[model samples]
Target: MEQISSFFHSIGTFIHSKHQQGVYNTVCLAILLGLPVLIFLFSFFICCHCCCCSRQRKDSSSSGPAHGKKRKKKEEDLWISAQPKLLLLEKRASLLV
Candidate 1:
């Protein structure tokens, strides 16, 4: 039992010594604390970038049709006038049937 206790004590002393003077503590602290902070900052910047891009798209689309695309009002008006005639023809054909 004494041998086992001495072995454990020596192991503990070695760990303590390493902890006090080695780079192990610094690396452990960075992994435990710095990693989470770095991840949070990265995610925040990515979210902001995505939101800005989407907002730009929404603003541009809301501004109306792109340049060089003109509205064809004359063709639209002709189609509008033809609708009633087409409806009349459909009704007459249904009556004959």
Candidate 2:
């Protein structure tokens, strides 16, 4: 147990070598400590971006023809007029027969 603890102490001492110790090194250590937080934030943003794209696709599908009320009205009118024209053609065909 003493050997194991001393091994860890030596490793710590090696890592904290005076030549490599400074404010910049401290900041680097702090940044390394926060690396997991940075990775989580990156993944969170990627998930949000994916969700946004899926929502956009759903909105586009739901809003497709309904978005242009004027165009829908025009199509309805064309169909209404076509029915009368079709009836007239049928009547002319009956008279010829």
Candidate 3:
């Protein structure tokens, strides 16, 4: 804490010196405005990076070395798509037939 205070105090003394008034104001204004802009951009970048990484991780993990990708047979694909309409016994029998 004391070190931080001394650092700022040194900066204050430097800025308050006769030749540096504009330097002081400019530095202060830049920090005041630019700090928030920097924070917003950093947060936005982190959020986007995290979301993209998560999606990639999920996709890769699902298709990783252990669980290989299995292609469904055409017959299986047909049954899967027609599953919603298979409620009727007659329709189910017709399909089997």
Candidate 3 residue-wise lDDT, 1-97, digit = tens = 9999999998777656633566667778668769999999999999999999999998988886766668866535445565466566445544454
User: Would you list the clashing residue pairs of candidate 3?
Assistant: none
Model 2 poorest ten-residue lDDT run: 72-81
Q: Which of the two, 1 or 3, has more lDDT?
A: 1
Badly placed stretches (over 4 Å) of model 3 are: 1-21, 67-97
Candidate 1 wrongly placed segments (more than 4 Å):
1-21, 66-97
For residues 43-68, write the lDDT of model 1, one tens digit per residue: 99999999999999899988987776
Lowest summed lDDT across 10 adjacent residues in model 3 is found at 88-97
Q: Name the Cα RMSD for model 1.
A: 15.8
lDDT of 2 by residue, 1-97 (tens): 9999999999678658733777777677768768999999999999999999999989998977655434654454434456788888888845564
Model 2 residue 8 CA deviation (Å) reads 20
Error of 2 at 33 (Å): 1.8
